[model samples]
Target: MTASRPAVEIFANPRADRSAPRPGVLTHEARAEAQAAIRAWPGYAPTPLLDLPGLARRLGVAAVRWKDEGGRFGLGSFKALGGAYAVQRLVREHGGDVTFAAATDGNHGRSVAWGAKQAGARAVIYLHAGVSPGREAALRALGAEIVRVAGNYDDSVRQCARAAAERGWQVVSDTAWEGYREVPTAVMAGYSLIAAEAVAQMGAERPTHVLVQGGVGGVAAAICAELREAWGADAPRFVVVEPALAACLLESARRGGRTEIPIAEETVMAGLSCGDPSPLAWEILDTGADDFAAVDDAWVPPAMRLLADGESGDPRVVAGESGVAGLALLLAARERSETWAALGLDAGSRVLLIGTEGATDPEIYREIVGRGADEVAGTVAR
Candidate 1:
């Protein structure tokens, strides 16, 4: 795995707050193209913006909402939004009638495989051994070849990048470096579609803040960047949340310079347990994020259960660990009322947290939620 590239090189302009434009980031035209490509994606769902009235009651906020990405496009996560669009853009520009490849802890690879299938291409997905069998099976069921690597997500990314270089396969990765910005940019752009849809879904009442789950930081950057545009001078407060084991952005932010956190990433939220941020994502986030937070593995599960168990007799939300971990930030935010007080959140403030994934890794989810896979599933469905 590569060390974190300097944020200045990637983003160039860093601002104290996200409201001002950064220098040399994605151009408006490029963003528009990405928006168009994401809309063109087959099986794309403008996912629901769910109201969590009970959770709002708990947080003492006016409202709480979830952007549900579970079971989106048959993959159990939101990473597909970026992965699939990246694959389509790469295949269209670079080559066609060929194969697409990616390395992911779970979601991104599944997305690439799914998109390649739709685009009439083949795919090879590299996964670390930590990935649950359920996720592996899901990829294989989509007709994509799954290769088990022996290390963490960062290791798998390196392995996949090398193999793609040698085997003449196109890689649609969310992480990027000097010469690798093309696909990562497309990936980030594709991911912006989420916030695009989300901003529209909000209508007149915009969210006061967003709690976006960070893996390689692609989706977080995408969502934050679009919010920058949608909200313009008054963009919502952007917070990047991650597993404690892999707070590359948080650690980097602390160092006042870029830092590569070596992650023996041990979390049930495998999707966010990534070591390095995409260079592009790092760039956007370093300048755009108002603050960063990390939560322990213990916080991930109960939150999953809380969502999957439903609130106030509603059907269960079926949020797996990776998805629901985003809301753990809400819990912490409420716990430290002072943290949000300065951000101006009160009962009238609308908060958006992503339910980013479904049951992509059921074993991990069950272990986190302290229930068998089937035990509480019907509750979510009912």
Candidate 2:
């Protein structure tokens, strides 16, 4: 398929307050605490940081590194850290009997359900109409009671909130709204575990750029906060990439505040098809993110295929639609000389892209990459 070129928006975050007394949403202490807690969890291990020398040569960059979260806890997404950790915290603070609820396109709901089960709590997940059956089935497999809503992802989030309020269930959401900051704060802090691992793995070598996928901006904010804490004034330039159809972060950055985009159609990037920016996330990303770029859905599949097939000698990676967004944006940017220069990307640039998921939806994965995730993983293993 001939993918439409991505539209790039380069912005310097003027409001980015990298100052101390960091936003209460996520702090260095919270990140360290989360890292310790997650390390103690069963099967908790740092995901691989893959060096794609061949891909770097092909893209004409000094180096390209991929943080592979596809195998994170075997849940197939980095969200396993966020929702599960938040649910565990809530269960420990409140009680194991507390019911948890959240809205998700896919991964977060599964994490919530898994966390609830592990914590001996009940979970109900709300899904928008656009979520595929495979995704819903995955949540059901985790024992979450599913509620299908008629609207988009934001609508489902609202439904989840309403149901949580009426039924007295605790909402373990990744997105934040007014009077709903703490849980999402915890979620974003949990995500800082990823940044911590990447930083440690990079050792003395730091990338010049870090491309993060933008949803409600939780992951991007968490990564930016953690990187700033680690690298201080020398942190890599952080870029946020999202689907063009649901570019809430881009819209919010353009407007200079938290803003919502009305979703007219669903983008293939189910995980990133968010209409609203999380207020808690915006608190950090407003100044933390360096640039925001929106890509067409068509760019996603080729990225998934490229990772699965392994460019040059890079090992095959199983990144899903949402997981491949950063790489997709990077690939798209390389085609435009002006966009590449604006980001300061060139032969001497070292870049890091987070593959936030594997084939969370196996059917869609097979269709896009022309092979199942298991097949690619097994091939890579050999």
Candidate 3:
């Protein structure tokens, strides 16, 4: 199943029209259906979009809106949306009593494992060789069997794929390739509910811009498609951010096609690491994206520092490397003052960003960002 893989283009210093309109993404019916399905979770918690005024002032932006997915199901990441949707749909489609199984990079696997328990099923997750022991332990605590792969995330995904094929276990994955588009597509659709909620919460004061992190592009695809569809041509400008070392989406934009890379992607932002762009999401983001930016590991520590210092003057938020790195992008854009001008990001501009996860590996988070925010805060309060 070897195929043509293109080198990805990283969009930045964008030369294209910022306001160029794209086609509609999800339909009203599709959105409503997805919303209803999420509501059925019963235990679904309302993740908030905090208005980061202090952070916004620091970034020189009119406003910064954050969709904090920390402590989401006590899992500390946003992958719960995809994992949950994939499990429920898989069980219903194939007929099951509520069990799910998959390999993960910690967050996704745990999300699936947690969702399976909620859906009345069990999950076994596999991981790549280098996954931190802390993450493996966390996944196991969710009651998943953690299998180690020989290589990277995609490699573990392949192992999961083979296992699912042979054992008839459902693989709750976000990335899609040949002959396996439906469930992943559903996962993307499910994630779209996040942006939908953001928009709904904003109401008449919808965000004028969006900055989404890219892994395999499921969350980005969902947001881009939904923004275009729900808001039409006049919607907010869209931008994507990724780790400089693990920017597979940016590589795809360069090659003018979906590109595969060396996968030597060692970075603090493990959540945003992917060697290939999901084909389905690539198709949607090809021309729909406005810009792409890469943040170095250098900026993550500072951003993480800031995420912990919220409006409450306490370290209220905990995030993974990629999660906090998004703040780096927002701050840079605000500093450059060019993207802001180009996108008409004035005082009125309401911009949105995602805190995709909270410390997928607390030990790793402590290592990267200096003593975990949660720990330092607890110590301070005591």
Candidate 4:
């Protein structure tokens, strides 16, 4: 099946000022602490930074590198780092039989549940009606008590907050509200580990641009902070990508603050279908991110299939619908010369894209990519 090129809306951040103090909540010291703590966990190792030469050639770029987080802690997403680290830190600071509660489209909740279990605490996860049954089952497998909300992702978040307050459960959320910022801050800090690994893996070869998929923007903020610290004034151009249907970050950038969009429909990129920009994440991305781009959901499946059918000796990648947003946006933008130039993309540009997950929902993944992750991996092995 041939997928049509996605339509994109690009907004350059007018508030992008990288002046005196950095715009991020996470400091280098806090990131270091989170990294050390996470490294102590069992099965903690750096995920791969794959060089996609064929893609680079096809896209008329110098290089296209993918930071694959599919196998991160075996959770199938990079989110495994954040919530788990925050839970560990929470347990260390405030002892006792605590319970963690939060809302998720899928991946973050699973990570939080796994973290709570590892920390000898309990977890309750709230999912919106759109969350797939497979995702709920995954959360249940991680020992989280599940509550299904009738509304969208934002509604689920509100429900989780109320339940946590009433039940005395600490919220280990990735998004931050007015008075509830600490845990989410810690979660963002933990995500800096990805940037650190990617930088080290690249060695002396720095990327010219980075396209990060955004939900509430925690991961993008974390990456921005790390890159800013490492490259100072010369950090690579950062673009936050989202599903057009649920582009809170893009809308927030256009509005010049933390803006919430009322969700009218669900996007195929379930994980990126967040209606609100995380206040904590927005603090950083407002200034640190150069541009915000939104893509049609139709682009996702084709992006996933492209990764699964690796080219020019590049190993197959098992990116989920949400995970392929960065690549989809890149492809969409490249089709328009003006958009490509606006993003500073050229033949010499070295681009970095994050493959945020494997087949987290195997059923949906197979439907999109035409094969299971394991099957693709087996082919790669041969």
lDDT of 4 at 120: 78
Model 4 lowest lDDT segment of ten: 1-10
Candidate 4 local lDDT, residue 140:
96
User: Model 4 segments beyond 4 Å from truth?
Assistant: 1-6, 379-382
Give a tens-digit lDDT track for model 2, residues 169-230.
99999998778888998899899999999999999999999999999999998998899888
Q: So what's the TM-score on candidate 2?
A: 0.96
- Overall lDDT per candidate, in order of appearance: 0.75, 0.88, 0.73, 0.88
Q: Give candidate 1 misplaced runs (Cα > 4 Å).
A: 1-15, 22-24, 336-345, 370-382
C-alpha TM-score for every candidate: 0.89, 0.96, 0.87, 0.96
lDDT of 3 by residue, 1-382 (tens): 0123211223643333435443234445655666679867766767887777776666556778888877566677888788877787777777665345566667788778877776667787888876789888988787777788898888888888998788878878888878888777777777887887787887787777788998888888888877777787776778778777778877778767888876775767877767878888877777778777666666677777777666435335677777875676665455555544654567666778888887778787778667775675452111
Model 4 gets an lDDT of 0.88
Give each prediction's root-mean-square deviation over alpha carbons: 5.1, 2.0, 5.1, 2.3
Query: Candidates ranked by lDDT, best first?
Result: 4, 2, 1, 3
In candidate 1, position 50 carries an lDDT of 86
Question: Candidate 1, residues 1-382: lDDT per residue as tens digits?
Answer: 1144211111112344644584235666767787787676666668888888887887788888888887566677777777888787777786668888899887888888888988878999999888888889888988899889998888899999899899988988889977889888877777777788888898988888788887878888888878887677588777778776677777777766556788765677778878777778877777788777776665666677788777776556778777876677566555665655744578887889888887777776677777754677663221
